[model samples]
Target: MFDTLPQHLELIVLTFLLAGLVKGVVGLGLPTVAVGLLGLVMPPMQAAAILVVPSTVTNVWQLAAGPRFLGLLKRLWGMLVGIVVGTLLVGWLLAGRNWPAATPLLGVALILYALLGLSNKRFRVAPRHERWLSPLIGVITGGVTAVTGVFVIPAVPFLQALGLEKDDLVQALGLSFTVSTLALAITLSQHGSLLQADVLGLSLLALLPALAGMYLGTWLRSRISPLAFRRCFFGGLLLLGADLAIRGL
Candidate 1:
C-alpha cells in the first residue's frame, strides 16, 4: 500500500505522525511541528496547505470533547472574528507566491513559543478586561497565523491567562485552533495556494498517519511523564526553530 507513494509522501507522512503525536500528548503543536519541519524542505505556504485538513479534524475532536463549547464560543466570538479578518487580510497580501520571505518570521514564532513553554510563564487576565483583550489578541494571533501558519503565541498564552479549568482550557484551545484552521483554509483558498489537485489529495492522505499518531500519543501520555516530555518537546521545537531561522536568513 505504501510502495506507490511518491518519495515526498513518505516525508509528509512522517511529519504528520510526529506532529499528531505531539498534539495527542500535549493538546497542541500539530501545525507548529508540521509547519516547522515541513518548511525545511518546502515553502511555508505549502506546509500550511498540508496542515489544513488534519488540524481541522483533530481540533474538531478536541472542541467536541467538552461541555463548555457554547460558553467559550460566546466569550471568544470577538477573537474569532478578529482571527478571520486578520488572516484574510494578510493571506490576500501574500497569496499566489512562494513567499519564502515569511519563513524567518515563522522561525521566530516557533522559537518564542518554545521558550515560553520552557520558561513556564503564566499570564492572567481579569474577567472585567476579557471583552477587550480577546479581540486584540485575536487580531494579533490571526495576523501571525497568516504570516507563519502557526497559531500558538498570543492566542495560547492569552487563553492560558484566562484562569479556566484544565478541561475548559483544552476545549478553548480547540475552539481557537478550529477557527484558525478554518480561517487559514479560506485564506489559502483565496490565495490559490490550496487549490491544487495534488495538494488536496495529499492532505487527505496525510490524515491517516496523523490520526494514528494521535492515538499512539494518547496511549503514551498515560505511561509517560507529561512534564518531562513537554520539556523535551519544547527543546526540540527550539532547535527546529533555530534551524528554520538560519535557513530562512
Candidate 2:
C-alpha cells in the first residue's frame, strides 16, 4: 500500500491532491493535469486509471452541491444519454490494442476544443431538437471518455450553450462525468486493464490530496473575479491542449 510504501508513493499522492484541488476549484481538469504530471512517475495508462475514483467522487460532490439535480436532469437529458452510449461503444472498440494511436487523436481533440473555447462564439445545442443531438453527444462523449477520460470539457460547453444556469451547468457536468466514469470503469474491468492492486491502493491514497485540492480550489474561486476566472480556465485548457499535442508529436 502507498501508505506504507516509500518516497515514490508520497509523490504520487501529493500530485493527486494538487490535481484534485485544481479540479475542485476550476470545475474541470483532473484527467489532463494529474495524468500528465503523474505519468513521469508511473506508466501513463496506470496514471490515467488511478484518476477514476477521485474524479468520480469529486463530481458526485459537485452535483450534490449544485442543488440543481432536477433542472439539470431536464436540461441534460440528451447529453446524459449520449455519454453512456459513446463510452460503451468506444470502450468496446479499444479492447486488446496498443493505446499509442489514441494519444495523437486525444491531442487533436483537445487542441480543437481549446480553440473553440477561446473563440467568441461557443458551440450550442438546439435543446428543442433532442431527437438526434442527445444520442450523438452521448456517443461522442463516451468515445472520448474511453480514450482520454477528459470528455467533460466538450460536454460542459454544450450544456452551457444550451443556456443552462450556472448551477445547472455544474450539475450537468457532474452528472455527465458520473455516467461516463461508470461505463469506463466497467470497460476497464472487462478489458483487464485494472490489474494492479498497488495502483488501486495508490489511487485510494491519492483521495485525501484530492479532497484538500477541492477545498483549496473552492476557496480560490471565491477570490477571483468572474471574467478573470473565465479567462484563466480557458487559458489552462489551451496550455494543457498544447502540451498534449506536443507530447503526441
lDDT (CA) for every model shown? 0.88, 0.68
TM-score of each: 0.95, 0.84
Model 1, range 1-249, lDDT digits (tens) per residue?
122336678899999999999999999999999999988877777788888889999999999998899898898899999898888888888765666668888889999999999999898899999999888899999989888889997899999999999999999999999999999899888855355667778889888899999999999999999999999999999999999888899
TM-score of 2: 0.84
- Sliding window of 10 residues with minimal summed lDDT for model 1: 1-10
Backbone clashes in model 1, listed as residue pairs: none
Backbone atom clashes (below 3 Å) for every candidate:
0, 8
The lDDT, on a scale of 0 to 1, for candidate 1 is 0.88
